[model samples]
Target chain A: MTFWGDYRGHGHPHESSWTMLGPLVVLAVLSIVGGFVFNVPEILSGMFPIKEATENGGPGEMVLTGISVAFGLAGIALSWLMYVVNKDIPEKITSSLGGVYTLVYNKYFVDEAYDAAIVRPLVQGSESVLWKTVDAGLIDGTVNGMGTQSQGVGSLLRLLQSGNIRSYATWVVIGAVVVIVVMGVTR
Target chain B: MNLLEILIALPAAGFLVTLFIPRKQEHLTRSFTLIVSLLAFVLSLGLVTGFETGKPGQQFVDNVVWIANPDIHWHVGIDGLSLWLIILSTFLTPIAILVSWRYIHKQVREFFAFLLLLEFGLIGVFAAWDLFLFYVFWEVVLVPMYFLIGIWGHDRRIYAAVKFFLYTMAGSVLMLVAIIYLYTLAGTFDYATILDLFRSGRIGLSHTEETLLFLAFFVAFAIKVPLFPLHTWLPDAHVEAPTAGSLMLASVMLKMGTYGLLRFCIPLFPVAARENASWINVLAIIGIIYGALVAMVQPNMKKLVAYSSVSHLGFVVLGIFSFTQMGLDGAVYQMLNHGISTGALFVLVGMMYERRHSLAIKDFGGVATAAPWLATIFLITTLASIGLPMLNNFVGEFLILQGVAQAKFAWTAFAAIGVILSACYMLWMYQRVFFGTQGKEPGETVKHHMPDFNVREWLCVVPLVVMMVWMGIVTQTFLPAVSATDASILDQAGTASALARPPVPPTGGITHGGSLHAR
Candidate 1:
């Protein structure tokens, strides 16, 4: 076996077994020495404004801090017990909750509720009301209606384009008479 | 010929030549269009080289009388605001031609002819100094794009094409009336002359007249920007358009709307823009959030990218309305960045479509394993799209946020939610399409036969990817050009507003951070 391969599976007896921890040990040592040398904690405390409140030492502030730390620790302990130490505890608790458990498990059916309430209506409304009714029925209907109307008007107007000079002259004379009558009355 | 004239004429000349090429000669038609687009791109570089940074006005001007009675001039030039956009147009056209190389089969000659025509119209829109010319070019863009989408597009092409045309045409009619009114007042259609007249109070308009005129132009551009409710046409148009059409639509064409806001809308009606800034910013913020939310649920890949453009462009509009130098600069830079990143995304999606003949997200799986190179590029673009740090989108988004924060902290906070939501949707889409198990079920008839990037595909994407990274890191290269223009815009807007109203105390004017403060 190659030396590295063997070492990966099993360590050499001559070497210290803790040699793998070398980097961590070095980091820890440096951190300790550097913290003391540089007064790191004091410097970091100076960076935060909350230090002023702490320095005032009000009983209210102390009580709030105490409550926060206590709750934080309790939460961590409970998570550890439920997740790492005894995972079945969570299942037991969930079973006791019954319907509530299902509710949480299914995310309270929020997605389904949203679909029924919002998405479905929106999709249906846009597809039918907005697109079909408004767009096609109203807008396109108006636009295409104009085109069709123009075409109908053009076909009707085509009657006047007959290539007969006598007929055209008679229409012009009649139009002039109507125009003069209307103009005279309006004036 | 001056460089600007050559830039405009080169594409037109190519378009004319493309018409004479026989339909069967596809290779000749493709190669000729490619060469023409590349030549235009090369000539446009001359503008960059000759351009004097920090110069206050338009360069390489080629003005001549086109219509004497109407006093219409064929005036064209590039300011700092337009210079990069012009380069962006030139840059993307060749890539677009390359993208359509194999995709467009029917009416090859006509396809390229329309493409060149579109390019010509786009370049002219950026370069034109005459409002009439600008309006003409603006309308000219619609014809080819209309046909490109209608004829060459996918399912629902006709409906999409008609909708696109009518929507844009309806908005622009008001603008045409407004332009004529301005011409009647100023007795000219030249932008500089009209701007001078408006600035000097020679062409006096009541507050109501100015606001109404502003709305006319704003409605036109807002439709083009397709902000929110007016954005109904964009998804259908983008989804139906062929690969190259989407690339052009998302890249350079959309910028025209934002560019008009910068060039004509704000500068021409500064008092109105200032008066209405709050409402416009609100709409922009809504669009940013609303677009991102809608994009998250999109099943179609192309639709997702299309919606993202709405969201991305919301930032541009937001930045413009912020009325700060940083904001304007970011808006302009974001336009180019969106062109590169989103344009590349469409190209990538197009390549996949070519292979699978499908864009449904469910149809893709383990594509990363099948095509690592494609996935790599897609991931980079996805990052850029979501504004990941060290990519192009981040710089623009950051600057926009900073600018917005200076103007309105609350709006900036809301716009930041869009940034997070973008990351969520993009990464989620990326994971689903790329990381899962390979292929569909065995019983399915369509067998998975995904191939990685071939040589031609690489050619299309490499430049875009390079640009995303380069623009992110060395943003100074592009920002200096934009800064001068943005500074002038802000200065003019400031002067215009100060002239009209009392100076309000500065609110939320925090000092900017970052090394880019040199600007």
Candidate 2:
């Protein structure tokens, strides 16, 4: 990975200052010497109990430690050979990994997953379902529906509003006949 | 003249005066409206200073016969519950005036006139002790708010205004029918007289009649609170309303609904309130969670704040229905807290709108960098809104949750999620607006139009922020009066204020102890 940078035969030395490197120097010393002098995990454990490492039940701790160190060194060697010796191999390996490489490179698609499950659905639902369907469609629809329904009834009744006296006489006669009939039936 | 009479009259007089102010003299119009509202606030403070705590009753009362046949009276007063609410109305009126000072350029005279008229309606709503008078004040609030949103608002203002008007009118009409029915039975619209008649059993309501009446008043109030399914109008109203209009609508107008629930609905029909608590609580919880979930995805800022109101007010509704003194007190306190926090949120939103002429979240980036002072005030308000500990909302929400836990622990657990979701939406909206990835290279709007807080903006915000802190930390200044009033409300209803002292199991047993007035 270091070899992957633009490393010319001769490089220009960058400007350095105590304000910049002074902290770096202290951090470097702390990273090395602070580990033994002050154990962070040990200190933190008193306040917050650290979770015990899982028992894989495959091998003992000693064997697992040795295996992890060996694999770490092998990873360095492999990276060196791929990047320094032949830069093309890294790309080839990445291509071979394909979807897995993409997934891991995007940090296991955590942000994508969150967007898909929570964020996008909420936005889509709010816009399309809650706002559009429930609010604009159902609630407001019912309210407007009442108005339109009344108007429809009025339009039907409007036909009976003919100014002609003949139609009015007929409605009056029909009203009298229904009243008499209902009165007689009740009697 | 009685102080309450003067408090009500000052705004009415100011409204007429502002109406006569030449529309060309915009500065005079603004300054006069501000002065009137400031005077109203000052007079309202007199109520607080003279307010005798540890008494749960109406004070500074004024009565006069306004109508003969129906026995309607111009009755008005303040109580422990309505004291701060009245003050909240008076306090926010000037803020609303300041909010609209520069923004409302076209209808300067009429706008200030309408703003003063709105203050009058709001103060009247909190003060009116007679049912007819209350109804009048309630309907009066709608006219100015409708005009505020309609004339001064953004696109679709007409639609939002009409919808807001119709929704409130629909619910209030039912309430009117109920009020008339009560008057027919009791022979007067005076609240105290009717209470005396009902308590003495001279005026009786059968179970069915009581339930129906309760539903009528509750629906009216619920619509105002805009609980859940009925709340579709609020987002539209808040989003379409001008800055000052949104401030008043959120801060005081919405409290009218919760206030009605506490003042009229529960006291007049305690049995029905108790019987219906199960479903009302259900609706409130649904409102809490649903509002938060819906707000989480709002692309627009005003709409987001509007939905958050739905979530916050849900706690108030829940508290009201819980049938415990703690619950009632919490509900009342929460009302004041919501007024301060949400009112501040709307003002802040309006301030931002003034800069960019946009309410869309995506239109903003690096606001904190551009306007650090604005961002700082906004952060304080946001924290206050999300019920951050030692803020106004925290006290209200905590008391509400504690009260609910005593009545029904399950509800507290459910309602607590809303508290969490509140933080999620508010902070997320805060982040996207103020501290976006565009901070490195600010957007065009952020670089050019957005500026730090002006004197007027600071003046508009700082007092609300101060109140938020004051109400949060030294709750004793407010809560004792609220407790006194709520205890009286429960007592008058023949209810044990401290019902279910042992946190009863949710096995149909909680209401047994809570409802001494239960049929």
DockQ of each: 0.08, 0.37
Q: Residues B27-128, candidate 2, lDDT per residue (tens digit)? A: 999999999999999998999999999855688888888898779888888889888898898999999999888998788898889988998998899899
Q: Give lDDT per model, in order.
A: 0.86, 0.87
Candidate 2 share of real interface contacts: 0.55
Best by DockQ: 2
- After TM-score superposition, what is the CA distance of residue B447 in candidate 1 from its true location, in Å? 5.3
Model 1 residue runs over 4 Å out of place are A1-187, B437-447, B500-519
lDDT of 1: 0.86
TM-score of chain B of each: 0.95, 0.95
Model 1, span B243-354: residue lDDT tens: 9999999998889999999999988888788778888888898888767766777778998888788889999999998887788888999999999999999999999899
Query: How far in Å is the alpha carbon of A104 misplaced in model 1?
Result: 9.8
Interface RMSD of each: 5.1, 2.0
Q: Top model by lDDT, which number? A: 2
